[model samples]
Target: MSSSDGTAADASWERSDGRSRPPPTVNTIRRIRQACTNCRHRKTRCSGERPRCMNCRRVDRVCHYEPYSTTNPPSSASVAANNGAAKGKSPSSLFPRAGVVDISRLPLATRKSRQSSPSHRLLSINIRLPPPSPQTPFPTCQVQCMRFTTAPPPAVMDHLIDAYFLHVHNQPYSYFHEQSFRERVNYGLIPKCLLFAILASALKFSDIEYFQGSIREATEAYAREAWLAILHEHLTVENNPTLAERTLTLLTLFYIGGRTSSGWLKIGLAVRIAQDLQLMREPKNTMPPIEQEEHRRAFWSIYLLDKLVSVGQSRPPAIAEEDIHVQLPSDEETLRRGIWKKTPTLHQLINWKSETESSVNGTFTQTILAATALGRCCRYVLHGREMDEMPPWDPRSDFTLLNTFLLLIDHHLQVETPSIPQIVEHYRRPDGTLDFQSLEHVVFARIVFHTAHCLLNHPFLLRMRLQKSNCKVPPKFLTRSFQISCNHARSISSLVEDAIASGCHVQSSFYAYASILAGGILSLAIHIDQEKGQVTDPETLNHYQKAIHILERTGRRWDHASKMVSLHCLFRAIL
Candidate 1:
């Protein structure tokens, strides 16, 4: 909430009313712009403290703050007007109320409720058109629907669209090419479901207005409207790609985690749609190269999401590596230029040799490679225990295979990826807009890389593997793996530190999960040290603090992030 109230000078001294009322002797107590959820619900004064406020502390609860949109205090003139049957009442929620023109009805969208505050904007939009014209291009039914559509004005859509490319257009949620999507929006050619999906997911980051108060509500509102729009749409071979895009967008609403999204079912639908379109295989006909890239990028985007959303969970990914046959996507630049180039398939990248490392690898290609490694790492942790098992120290074991795959990924990163600082610098354009897609690959690569390391050497996983096999493993190997996990835990924190310092924000809630998972390693160690009555390493504690810091920053935008902050502050290690 940017404000104009604080800068007026001599306000206290000038008692303009000219009654015997004098200025107060005490100075005003400054308050934060918004209160914590509990304080707001209780209608109590909130100190707006970090992590936990005084009221939350009193109740032994987590202090949560979803990004809020509050209307400015009404002036006396407007206050008087609100009482009358006036033409211009202030907009109530961020989006308009349903069936209220200009406070338009929702589109084909989802209506699933989340565990959040009720004081939220219903995600809806409206354009307030003149009486229907014969020249209107829409069908009569669509024309009727458009009058109640709650879509924002074009100017606001511009901001939300920009935010989408900057924040939501990369990693676990990449569905559209920047150039093509913007062109569609410019031409009024984008599907309502896709447009609203982008708006809903990008709303929290946009910080445009106070939708009555809760931005999350407004965001979820957009999702609901998009869902409504999609329901009436006829699903067919030609519409399968758009349907996949819509489903993936809905799944991305789960970024902050929690009950906000039905990721599994949505992603399954998206993946199956891509497979049905034969997106996994390269095109065989006279299809343009640009069209081929679109198909490849779309499929890989789903693949990237599958890899990210499935981590630390029990189920397998929808698109297995073996099932994918298309070449990986090209770089952002080429995609923007609508050009395609020779690229490696998933297998070629995974089975890389030093002599045959001649494939042209771009940022997106690197991201795909990193995601594949992450998938393999996850599989190793969750399902690598084959019935015909070998000793932990054996060369032919699952552990060894994981190590080998990790090395392959490391080699590719070393060969193709830019340094973190270089990527940050590259993100800043001369025109002042950020090239977030470029920076996203680096962020995703680093996050996935370190997160996989943390997952691989997780102490519980280590202990379970050893216990299950009952094999005589070398102490040195086990000791080194522990060292590796600890190093990567700190590495995860370092990634956050660098991201913040460089102003390259961690855009996804999935990235925050990495930091939390990394913190778990240190948390387990400190807990163990406490049980043994020994001193924990100071350096380890510092890294743990950094992890918490990222979570706190993310919490301001995301409720689940805020919830995690509350949980971490209590110092429990369900790592």
Candidate 2:
């Protein structure tokens, strides 16, 4: 019965529709899913993976696996063939079209040579990044890409801004209109460049405990952040030119960066930008009164920088006083209240010798006037405008005219030289209010006033003036000049000492050198007295020591001051 049935089934199958029903391709002897088709063809071990195996995935092939039943078991021969296959090795060696060599079988020399060839190696890539630096943890690109949210807390920023305005803004650097700046700060509209720049310089003056121990490092760190912000702004490239000007000047006004060679360039760039905006010229009458006052303030600030940064005549001031058509800044009350008044010019002040005409100028205008006079003195000294045929002793000489100009400046400002120097007291009221703007004006006016006299009586300039002249200089003239210089130098030191003691430090950058110059002069005078066989008095020695001490304190805040302190020649007689 079985033979007859099998014969009938075989005949039916042979005559079956071969197109409709397909036959099993393999003998089905291999165990189910023991190997994938690709792996099996390469005689390699399979991971028994579902859907797609690693070997198939690597080659981008469609994967297929045969099914099994519990009722039926696979042969041991199939299992053995799969088990002995190569493990963890690429099956590319089995196919000529794979285009990858089994480098493990290659000789040592050939493998090493191939290993060194980037083109011949596998296509997989490896990337490595450098560790962060200790000083600047974030690169500019990293900060930009990662979005640095790590600025000083808003409270800290408020204090820093206060420090800047109170200590820094009062110097001739009063380009910022306080009302507008404070309004912008309240709105959180200030730029990071300007914000960070203020923080950088003001950290030294800050009372924040967070910045207490490491003032230098914190200041430098903020400066670096400000630098990054400035570079980032450059990408936007002058979208806010006023902000750019203010930020650069704020940085130039206090940070060490503004004092470097680069800072000098920044000064020129800033002044040029201001000039481009017609800040060098007077604001038109059609302009808003408040806006006109703003432009006037901004121009005066830049003008002061020009005067202060001029290193004698070797580096001439960018703003020629003759070229300046803008008026001096308004009264502090007018500026604070937005009440703009047109102030007078240097020429107008010089001509006002009439006793009946009380000057309408405030202390700030006096600062401008004093700085103007100082500019003349620097140019006079550095230009070596020696009356070669006529001695400086001549009453009609340019030197004598300059001396007269200084005295006229004193007269216009109504300056009374007090016997014992007193710090400016009105900057703070009875209830602990700071009239910082007024204070800055008064303090800076005094400093620039004294600095001018000190430079005028500088022995260096005196020698030059006497060098070229054939006239016999009077010993009395020389002694009087020396005494005047010593007196003014002492005055400068005393002003610094009393101001600091009163919790009102002078905020001007020029004070760094002014204090040093004063100290230098007093030291020389003491030694000169010693050379004349007179013993150095305790008061004289004490004054010199106080000057050095003040300088050391200044050095902690200003990099240039530190260098000045280190120079042995700066205090040659004492050293």
Candidate 3:
């Protein structure tokens, strides 16, 4: 067997038979293990990147280091002295005196010595070869080489991280059209794997205390590659997961407005990646829960509806025009006669070869929901209007379930804290409070937020006015009570009257909760006065002013009443 100290690490000796024997493990190989100067310079956790590192290419960098293994064996005393160090010393210190034991120091032993000590025959050590140096195509593997132990270079690390984020931003997800576009959609422009790699790289590169923790959580949530492998594997086909992950990231970014461009790009990428996944023929099911939902929703909302609408299957006869005095059909009748009543032709177009539950029906339902939301969004965007004038959209009630969800959400948000428990409990019990996140809470939250966003076009001042003719009690009681029991019918009626009369220009949307609140306050004032038997106008005015100030300070505006309807008139001068 050849000695390991003075020859290239790959060199081997021929055995008596046909096979070649590995070079002997030398003092230097034991001392350095696989650690090399280049790896230390780059601070890369090397997988011993073969030919070159899969990780380095992801970041657009060159991998370089000196290969320092040879065939010569060091003396027994030298080996013993080096190994005698505390077990805690690193495995790469088999030569005690040399910081990095050079292969040149130990030359191969003679054939006589190999024969004399057959048990001591050298065995080859496995160490990664470094990439080529500038002067040579092959890496420098001199018998004598310098070594140091430290992290990788900062510039190299920066380059790697930057590459990772770029890759992620470029991941592809395309909109569905014809089957012919499948290849372009799936593999076109950017791929999903690149997007994952970017996120993983960002988390790895960030110096924040929670970066690692976030990566771990994301890895579990996104069902993507591990953080390291993002850079480690780059954009290879095996690494790409799904578009849902990209969509989820995009949605969060849209909501939060953090890293704006990066977030939006992720959405586009998700669309492309999703199309890629759709075209895949293999049976696979390792998607994360969030992704599964996004995938289902995206397909239904984006593609299936177009197909249905194209074939006239979803069309409804136009409703006859009538005067304002004519009571239009109830919201339920309108929806049933107009949209939901018709069956659609979407089923045929979406029947893929796989004999599984048809995605078409689910897509159809989702598309309808999406269309409704889109209508609301467009209405507000164009007309600058609110849904307060329209009937609620409860699917279970006269309205669609989606509309009811919006109403509940509006009611909840109008209150001080929009807890899911409190909103759910409002329908269940007026006095009870609930805690904890529930499925009902999440579903409603989704429905309400999406619909409200669709409906609300512009921001406007929200004001409340308590009527003097109806108030005999303290106003504080009314504000507190009405804010709590937001749905009490009588209170809502009173507030609506106040909002209509209030001269302050306001968006009609604010009237819903604000009107109810004003009525509750008026009732409270009336009750207080009745309890006292009689209250002077000045005293009533003082209470109204105090309560109004409280509301204003708390971010609740109530300036809508006519200027003549002053604080003094609020309690009707019941001194």
Task: Give the per-residue lDDT of model 1 (tens digit) for 129-246.
Answer: 4435567665543333332235665456678888777777764445566776676666556666777777787786876753323455557656655655565452533554655455
Output candidate 1 Cα RMSD. 18.1
Q: Give the TM-score of candidate 1.
A: 0.71
Kindly report which residue stretches of model 1 are placed more than 4 angstroms away from their true locations once superposed.
1-149, 210-212, 236-241, 354-360, 383-388, 415-419, 426-433, 531-534, 571-575
Tens-digit lDDT track of model 3 for 188-302: 3333333333334333234433222233343322223322233344324465454344334333322212233443344444435545656212122364322333334344332
Model 1, residue 5: displacement in angstroms? 63
User: Can you give the lDDT of residue 479 in candidate 3?
Assistant: 46
- TM-score (all chains, Cα) for each model: 0.71, 0.68, 0.28
Name the candidate that leads on TM-score: 1
Question: What's the CA RMSD for each of the models?
Answer: 18.1, 21.4, 20.8
Runs off by more than 4 Å, candidate 3: 1-256, 279-419, 422-575
> Which 10-residue window of candidate 1 scores lowest in summed lDDT?
108-117
Compute the lDDT for candidate 2. 0.66
